[model samples]
Target: MKRFQVFAIIILTGAMLLVASCFWPKDNIVVGERIIRFIPKEEILDFKVKDNTQNVDSVIAMLESRAYGINEKAIRRNSILDESVFSESDYFVNPKSDGGGTALDNFFRYLQKSDSSLIRIGHFGDSQIEGDRITSLLRIMFQDKFGGSGVGYVPLDDVTSPVSYTRSSSPNWVRYTVFHNRSAKGLYCPGGTVFRYRFATPESTRDSIGSNGDTIKIKVPACSYSNATVFLKLFRGYSVAKLWYGKATEPAELKVYNSKTNELLAEVVLDSDDPFNVMKLPLKSNPVTLKFVFTGPSPEIYGLSFDPVVGVQFDNYGLRGHSGDGLLTISSDLLKAELIKLNDKLVILQFGGNVTPYVKNEASLNNIKNSYDRLYQHFRKAMPDASVLVIGVNDVARSVGGTYASYPMVSRIRDAQKEVALKNGCAFFDLYQLMGGENSVLAWNKKGWASRDGHYSDKGREIVVNELYLAIMGEYNKFLIHGTTAGK
Candidate 1:
């Protein structure tokens, strides 16, 4: 009886093992591939191969030839040939194609050329540029290397609930956004006067104030107007106006005196916008502080000019959840306008950070490159004369057999990005290799350059930006001094 029981137990255990084998799932994480979906139709249409580079030997050559010829034909027919499997990231989304070398050199020449008296370099990125981390550092470096001053654009006010700038106050005004989905009741205002009629004071008498550390400025003609005039008034300060009539022989002087104490503050003559005027004011304090006391019928305030130069660099155009879709999504008109505002525009498209987290198959991966094509077209249209660069994904690793291994497919995604840039005449910088080959981010995390698992630490970010800057500067110098070594 004991023997019979033993046999039955063995039989039951074997049956259970068989069932488990049939039903249980296997681990699916691939080691090196990027998380990109290769949409077959889109891939063919976007990554066509060109004929000129048909016989080149390197990986870059083969990839370019295949992409230009195949992608071009596919685009023409409104079709794609992406049979490649999806990988781990979107680094290849909107990869460049064709005219890389010439595109790069021309962009460098543009940067070196000084068009504006005070050149402006606008570096727009997600949170990376926020608080002027990379932008500030880059600005200082560039200004030292090149020449420019004054922080180009500044938020008249900052409204982050957490507060990210140098100084912090309880609450100045409320904040509102046209692009972001949020609204405030207090003295909130959208980015610029962009979304008309949205500016207001929290309460009727509420006031919000901020300061630029050691920087002090006072407007000579506090009360001023321009183009269209509307009734205006000023409080808590002095004002002045100046005028030039048929080129006056001697500079005319007008003075403002305190009615009670009879304190002399400034001397000038009030002038009109229809006629240009220059006014000067003498401030009692070393750091000048004067408020506008205006009673005018003008729509514009003309006399509020400050020194054309200031400190710090800022570029905050990073989109957190975006997948190389930012350029494609921003309106053509708005993008063009912003590009025009930048003195030496440097566009760096960094992606694939999000794509690594989730991806399932090959076809999806190839289709991911289609997004790169969209990005290329959008950028070309938005900033026809701007310098564009691409930063591919860093090395990401996955756990395999009790250890982390670099997935083989990562190379494919890198190739895709390079091909796209080369084809589209844009410059591509390999962040993956720069960060130290496959699984480098893991090392960066170990060095505390990266956060606990993902994301970069302050130090890590600095390192990344420095490398980028060096690479960028190297290219710029090569082009500027060498003179058109590469053909378009």
Candidate 2:
């Protein structure tokens, strides 16, 4: 009888604790504008739209239908020529087909010439390609096939720590960007970020370097490149600069070092008054470091360009947290002149992921499309000869009803991007579908291919980039076969 009474008391205590826990104050977590609270089921459901589930389902269906043409077999194919399946909407050919040839046809013709001139490909994107993830793989593959030797463009003051190269600058260097809390003066060039070294006046002097000098160092990884070119601009007020390239331990001097050994290679001083200058220097071997010492007035630096004398160069112009519209901040004339100088043949714009989270309705979607269309038109104006390829947003997921599901807005953003690309006569790669369409992030996450927060894992990146490479090569192969005929 006493044991039964004790058991009843224990059960009553447990029930009391459960009731008290329900009444306890809950912590609210804010994500974007939504506040999340661990509350009663009724209260949580009340905060969500009544048709949210149906809307997500409808968007998923649409995405699935659109992705039906993604040839999984072609993506997995080993040989480029054997991969033939591709949707017409997957990549739009310029309808006008300048000079009786498509944009890609022209590129292929250039590739066949085997000339000494470089074929530059400018790849601009948001954080998706930051840190040289996708661009680095593409660069290696292209260089391996086409005979290029160095990693392409490396920004001056990069926020995204690039794995391809090591860059460190003195804290005194000032970084300026074209978009998002923009710089107060000077225009941004094709390479989204620029660096400036300002000298402190007598009253503002803080560092021992004084009012006249600063230094920055760039070190290529152990096996990346043997040569590099530093792109600089001497503004009206700036003066001369010196470049020192060599092994990390070697003294800075103009001398020849063994090509296979890491030693001091060479040094040069630029006293030119030209507004823009390209300083090309050879490195002793792969994994060489270059130091720049500015001894006079401040100079505006664009970035470093690294590539071989021949073959294709892929430049990664990745800006974090950017929508495509930031390109508009740069002057059209400057952008055009830079493109012409770079000999850019192909321009890839990968964006829309950053804008997806804010997409709430049709009007918002249209706004994104309109913004992208304007950007596309600007690129066409800037480089009419270049072929533009727009890569759509990747799959992003959000937690809904205690389960992670694909963000419903991602499909709409993808659709808008496709429309913009087609309307602008540019090719479109549906990266969202290539990532396996709606709710595919879950699978990727489960396979350790993507982070729970939605960014791709290293393995996931390889899988997606490989598929993209196949698609690009497939198009190139098609061009190789028909380009000559079309030109005639």
TM-score of each: 0.51, 0.70
Instruction: Please provide, for model 2 over 211-329, each residue's C-alpha lDDT reduced to its tens digit, 9 standing for 90 to 100.
Output: 33443233423222222222222111111122211111222222333333435555444354433445565543433345544433445556666666776778888888888687888
Candidate 2, run of 10 with poorest lDDT: 235-244
Error of 2 at 314 (Å): 0.9
Give the CA lDDT, 0 to 100, for residue 255 in model 2. Answer: 34
Tens-place lDDT digits, model 1, residues 1-488: 24567679999976675565455444433548754332233323344322221222242222223321112232211122232211112122222234544555545555545433434344444333444445555654555445444333333223321122222211322223322433221111111111111122233332333262322343333222221111111211112222111122233233444433445545444443322222334534312222322222211111221112322223334434445654454456645654564333556666665565454457756676777767766666666765567777655666543344445466566667667765666667776665555565556655666642335677666666655655555444344444542432
How many residue pairs clash in all the candidates, one count each?
78, 0
As a whole number from 0 to 100, the lDDT of residue 183 in candidate 2 is 59
